[model samples]
Target: MAVNGRSRVPTRRDLAEEELMLDTYRGRRYCKQHPSQQMIPLGVADVCPLEHSAAGEQPVDQ
Candidate 1:
């Protein structure tokens, strides 16, 4: 089977392994390191404005 750019033969073991991995994060939103925040599926590099702020800290008014 060709998915994206990778080709692999679908097997019971492969499906099982993929399911197991998905199960580990079935309901997860954010990453393990930032459990309180929402998951940024694409990435966080220069995309999240508050990425550098401390959790729960309010922004300073200009």
Candidate 2:
């Protein structure tokens, strides 16, 4: 989740995370901007990637 303010530095893996609104990874199709490009801010959801998927729970959970 997006904190009211910036607190920590984001990693390449964190940025590459696709679901969150603040994902600014270079690998993402939308954020053509470089990861280091500070013009835009970034954030991640508190939820996990599998939880966000329409496929529902992880296959291992069954």
TM-score for model 1? 0.30
Candidate 2 residues 1-62, lDDT tens each?
35567577767777756436444444333222232223332454222222223453423231
Best prediction by lDDT = 1
Clash list (residue pairs), candidate 2: none
Candidate 1 lDDT by residue in tens digits, 1-62: 68899998999998988768866975435534444555544543312323444654554332
Can you tell me which runs of candidate 2 are displaced by over 4 Å?
1-6, 19-62
Against the true structure, candidate 2 reaches a TM-score of 0.21
Residue 5 of model 2 has an lDDT of 78
TM-score for each predicted model, relative to the true structure: 0.30, 0.21
Candidate 2, after superposition: displacement of residue 18 in Å?
3.7
